[model samples]
Target: MRMAARPLAWLLLLGILLVTVLPIEWRPVTGEPANLERLVAFALVGFVFVVGYPRHWWLVLGLVIAVALGFELAQLLAPSRHATLKDAVVKVAGGSLGVTAGVAANFLFTRLVPR
Candidate 1:
């Protein structure tokens, strides 16, 4: 059961990465609050790690950073998608924040429910 859960968690993490990196136009919204998108991105990634790899938060965190870096490097291959230090920074920050949240959640959950 534990083995199966781990793979499922990884798949879910991959799905989140795909959804995030895919190109999508930002639709214009009337008076949308600032930083909402970033918050959502961070929360979603953090929640995935928290629920998926509760015992290996560090691994998940490292994976997030590696993946983000890989994506940024890949962008260089596309003439239209040049790599930007700013984007990389944002990605790293988001991933780091997410991992922190996941770790905290894992701690709380473990304390709340012995396993």
Candidate 2:
């Protein structure tokens, strides 16, 4: 897990990028509903990113924020997507929570593990 974490983290981030730009009908509806998917998706991105680069978690945080911004902006040109400030805010907020969670988890794990 340690060795693969880095590449897996990048792949996860890339996957988000790919999914965002491509045309898809993947809006969060049903069950959890209303912005739930944003939380989960960004959270996963944050978790993998921090776990992969705990030594530079701040970089991961910045990268996630960049991802959020880039995706929202790219939506302006997407064929079926419409860009909106509201969506961008929700995405950034969700990404923020995710990054924080990742940082906290990494801190706790590192403290508990024998160095």
Candidate 3:
């Protein structure tokens, strides 16, 4: 799983970028609130990144945050999309939570697992 983590994390990040900059009509609706979707999506991305690159957890956190801010700004490139500070905050909050969880999980795994 560790060996596959980096690639999977990168793939997920790419998907996030593509979805963020696409036309609103092209975005999928899961019946969930828009902010909720953003929160969960970014959370998952952050979690996967940390899990895949445990040794570079700090770098992962920073990169995830940068992505959150950058992606929110990217919405400006899409005429149909609007960028807002509120949305960016929510995404950053979610990613932070995920990265925290990932770090805790990594710590426990290293301490308890027969590595």
Candidate 4:
């Protein structure tokens, strides 16, 4: 049987992108996190990315990095949004952690469930 389409995660990611690119005042309340928001966002994004595409974890990492940098570059256009090197570092770190967890989870699931 063919598997059903799973685009919800990607839609969520797009939403995240929208929120990320918006001005600070325009963005929704994602919690008290102010400086660490980038980290959290990338972590969640990386997690979902790996969960959605379990092949080539490193490629996912690259994509996460590219996305992070792309958003940072996009921020240059918004006077309210300023992308810093520190924020980029935090984003990469968070994504790495999330991707590592995802890889572990995928490995465990594959081991537990017969293909």
Candidate 5:
């Protein structure tokens, strides 16, 4: 599970970067609010990252936030996209929640499992 999650986490991050810097018209639509999409995307990535690399959870979290911020900043070069603090904040919040959940899960698993 951990082995699979590492690649999955990186793949998700790549997808996020592509979606973020693409032209607005080229972006996919889920009929959901854009902010929700961003939140969920970052959160899922964060959780998988922690699961894949369970050690140094704090570093994983910081890297997640950095990715969020870097992606948002990348928008400035997209011509059709713009960077905003509000969006960055939302991404960060989502990533934080995911990291917390992953850490808790790890904690519980270690406590309950004999090995």
Candidate 6:
């Protein structure tokens, strides 16, 4: 069961990466805050990793940070996308929050369900 779950988890992770790397224009709809989308994205990614690999949450977090930094740096190559220290900070904050939430969720899940 664990082995089968691993592949599905990996596919989910890859999908997350694709979504993260894809560039999208920021246009806030009415009643929606500007940064809301990004925050959700970060949180979702962190949560996914945490749930998928609870034993290696730190490693997953580290990799997410590294990927975010790399993506930020890559933005410099595009004339439309300039890298910002603020964005990097936001990414780290979002990722961290997500990881924390995921950990908490995992704890709750384990407490509720026994192996």
Over 1-115, each residue of candidate 3 has an lDDT whose tens digit, in order, gives 7778789989989998988999989898899999999899888888888999998888988998999999999999899999999999998988888888889999999999995
Q: For model 1, how does the per-residue alpha-carbon lDDT over 26-83 read when each residue is reduced to its tens digit?
A: 3234355524544455446655765676777778778777876786777666554556
Best by lDDT: 5
- How are the candidates ranked when ordered by lDDT, highest leading? 5, 3, 2, 4, 6, 1
lDDT string, candidate 5, 1-115, tens digits: 7899999999999999999999999999999999999999999998999999999789999999999999999999999999999999999988988888889888898899897
TM-score-superior candidate, 5 or 6: 5
lDDT of 6 by residue, 1-115 (tens): 3354456656755654544445545422446663565566676777777787888889878976876677667777655566788777777677788789878987898899888
Over all chains combined, what TM-score does candidate 3 have?
A: 0.96
For TM-score, the strongest prediction is 3
All candidates: TM-score: 0.65, 0.82, 0.96, 0.84, 0.95, 0.74
- Over the stretch 1-115, how does candidate 4's per-residue lDDT look in tens digits? 1011126446656876787688878898767675577677777777777877888788988988887777777778888888888777887887887788878888898899897
Q: In model 5, state the lDDT of residue 113.
A: 86
The weakest ten consecutive residues by lDDT in model 3 span: 1-10
Residue ranges of candidate 6 with Cα displaced over 4 Å = 1-31
Question: Candidate 3 clashing pairs?
Answer: none
In the range 24-97, model 2's lDDT, one tens digit per residue, is 67643456754677667787777777777778778888888888888889987888776677767777787778
Can you rank all candidates by TM-score, best first? 3, 5, 4, 2, 6, 1
Error of 5 at 42 (Å): 0.5
lDDT, residue 7, candidate 5: 100
**Local accuracy by lDDT, each model:** 0.64, 0.76, 0.90, 0.75, 0.93, 0.69
Off by over 4 Å in 3: none
